[model samples]
Target: MSGKDTGHGTQRLALPGVFTAEQAAVTAAAIAGIQRADGAIPWFRGHHLDPWDHIEAAMALDAAGDHRRAAAAYHWLARHQLPDGSWYAAYADGDATRPTDRGKETNFCAYVAAGVLHHYLATGDEEFRERMWPVVYAAVEFVLELQREGGEIGWRRDPDGSACDGALLTGCSSIHQALRCALALAELRDDPQPDWELATGRLGHALRHHPECFLDKSSYSMDWYYPVLAGALRGAAGRARIEDRWPEFVVEGLGVRCVSTNPWVTGGESAELALALWAVGDSERAARVLRWIGHLRAPDGLYWTGYVYADEAIWPRERTAWTAGSVLLAVAALTGDEATGAVFGGAGLPRGLEAEECCDRS
Candidate 1:
């Protein structure tokens, strides 16, 4: 099936031995059903809502032909934004007013730019762009303030309002992608943000050249692959990085491990690794990964977060919207969805001034 839904921008989002267009639609509908009346998507029905995963689920909805629900998710972020342009890390799903976690994570705040750009590219909705521009602008500005002298972004601002000390490689790499998306939107509106462009270039430099600037969470697969997945690292360099660590994090018949030391294989990490694999032009391996993780798909159309292969069980014993969201994104990338490729493929996004070209503010 071409996944030619009656909606705009539909395409063949199916992968052989993985999921069909009809099955993809069922998954999308299940995610839409998870949305609260106000459009915030939590981890699941009883779970807490975080800004980043909320947007991930929203982007998946767009991929699967549910743009209305995706737009609603973005609107919810706009409504919940604090005065300083950040959102509290976790909100109680049952009651939006109750914040379960008070820290403001820079990466989580910056992700709205990527999500907004993806939605706009998928739907080409002018009014939606106009409505979300301020949201994107403010959120990007909020995250940029956390950038360090070395170009790595500070991880979070605490509940007491002070910036956290060290930077995370995974988080900074993710911000690197978000900045590109933000700069793309800036150019689209005929309003170029030179500062953002410089920031993007600097962050890319940091991710590529200065791994020491970030805290060494080398045990986690995210820190290993996010640089490639987020577009900071590519070409032969990206391929080598992935190949070097393939043995440590991958479980052959299972998927990518959340941590090298754990016997657990996770859906989200595996799906994200597949996206990174696609980014590096290793589509065959990427498709293999997507197929490998299909065993985690539950009958409800949501994927179980991960399987503890050693224990023969799914730990955390939970299903998450982000896992489902990531799987769909990987499928969209594999199926050659135009918007998915545009955002994740790094061909059309503006590369900011290299770190040498810009005056250092940090």
Candidate 2:
């Protein structure tokens, strides 16, 4: 399907009997509404411009047939990126903003490479790929510099060049996927990538076997499923890890929680869980995860930030761009649909040594 073809896009992937055509139209319109005229997408209604969340919402826009806007959003990131291959933690509208003088976040910085790669794939724009390569290369270098002794990546870099000691399993896992995508892009363009290969392998090894080396944020849904979803975990062991935590983190028809005990279920986590479940060959379970969040949809096709457990009303009571994007991605995965094949289509799992082979073999 061409990028211009809107008929088979995200609109059609909505849950059966769940979202109507009118609802999907509202959702698409809502996404478009958050997009700035300059092509940047904000996370919420007003001036909330976060890079990671913005890229995520842009991906959804591409899925919904807004490639021009998605490309513009990427261009905006390129324009704003620091020379050291990082962005501030946050940005205020029409002004450069930063919480600290920090250079870049490991997770947030790594994510844009995937977004660029996705844009290239969806649109097949060679010029865009060429323009984006420098950004991808520089960002990967920044991430590699922060890698710790045991192969795990640090969380973020302070402006003074100091690193956060604790690593997050979820963050590293996402970076692993980004690294692979970067490597793939490098190879596609016939560029040399020996360093990328080595770094990617090391990071993948850390994710597969060295959870102890990272911060123990295992109580969260991201930590639970990111290994699988991020393409860092594979085979029998990967399957086992997901199965072990499945019951603990999932709350039946409600959705997945940010933390297992948080009593708040969110669209992003639920959709992410669906992607992870699909990776492990559990389409039935993946579909269930998607369905769990279907009811969270607002009349505008957007979703509330999260669902409150007590009243079951939407908590934060605000529609979120990323939340709607998450639902679109989950629905795409569940329905075997792809508005843009570039959007992380279940590329099996990461290649090379299994978790057991990496950790236990003599």
Candidate 3:
């Protein structure tokens, strides 16, 4: 065997705490086990599927070496996309039925861009990218239409085409990231977006300086870290923001709460916080965040949605496929693991603007 192989050998690395390689293998096996023959991955064993969770499951499949299954999931998305280039918010289990209208959530629709980009990276299929471009383009246009006068984006649009009540910093931040990915994909395919740079800059500026325009959601974890996470805040300002809210949202050994006053900590928020920390180059604290959720992993490798306050065993034990996927993506980023290079190693901040321009626009 090569020297590199000799050093690392074939020993399976343990996840957090008690999870051995054997356990991880079983967890991965279980995820695959839940995947339907047509490529739909249900959130849990025998449960129904939703678009957001389905895409998340597909990502996990890629991480676990089930590219074929992942591709099938993408194909599923492609087949069901609305004429406006969005997927329904939720779908029935196993089969695509009982579609629920989530009223055009920008983040929900934007998420597909990242997944399609990731799938293309994983498979290197030019045809797949070609097929997805029109969907991606139309979706971006749909989100752009929701941008308000002051540069902040509305959270969603109602089914009748009316705007949702207010803006969410977190939702907009996620959409900002997705927009960048969409633009990157556009560039990669030699179909650069004409106004993408300006639109992204406007959104970033609004997030950094125009907090008054958005709803007063400072207590929420998404509001706390999203600016930095979205690449809208950077350098000294980003660092300061995280430091200011660290104690309020972070719950020591349990991870981060979705909101400071809620006293409920969730795996998704914790993992996402780790992601924000990673974006700002704080790998040490990022690792700590990951370790917090690492302690919460079930024997099946899935993660419970949230943990209850004042008691460890009283936590909500329902596993979410997105929670596990977020944790995996965070861990990969923290460790600089090349196997997950595409997902974790994207350009740190959104390109095409200076930090001053991004943060100081009036």
Q: What is the C-alpha RMSD of each candidate to the true structure, in Å?
A: 2.8, 3.3, 4.7
Best by TM-score: 1
- lDDT string for model 2 (120-170, tens) is 766788888889898888888888888877778998887777786789999
lDDT of each: 0.88, 0.74, 0.70
lDDT of candidate 3 over 129-232, digit per residue (tens): 78888878888887888888777788877878788878888877777777777877888887767577667767777788888878898888889987777666
Error of 1 at 62 (Å): 0.2
Q: Model 1, residue 245: what's the lDDT?
A: 92
Give the lDDT of residue 229 in candidate 2.
83
User: What is the TM-score ranking, best to worst?
Assistant: 1, 2, 3
What would the per-residue lDDT of candidate 1 be over residues 1-362, giving only the tens digit for each residue?
01223233334777887787767877777787888989899998888999999999989988887888888889899888999999999998824699998999999999999999998988888788888899999999999999888888999999999999999999998888999999999988999898898788888889999989999899999999999999998999999999999999999978999999999999999999999999999999999998999889999888999899988998888888889999989999988887888889978998888877665554
TM-score of 2: 0.89
Residue 278 in candidate 1, Cα distance off native in Å: 0.6
Q: Report the number of clashing residue pairs per model.
A: 0, 0, 1
Clashing pairs for model 1 are: none
Q: What are the clashing pairs of model 2?
A: none
On lDDT, the stronger of 1 and 3 is 1
Cα deviation of 189, candidate 1, in Å: 1.1
lDDT of 1: 0.88
Candidate 3: lDDT of 51?
A: 67
- In Å, residue 8's CA in model 3 sits off its true spot by 16
Model 3, TM vs. native: 0.86
Q: Candidate 3 regions off by >4 Å?
A: 1-22, 45-50, 338-345, 348-362
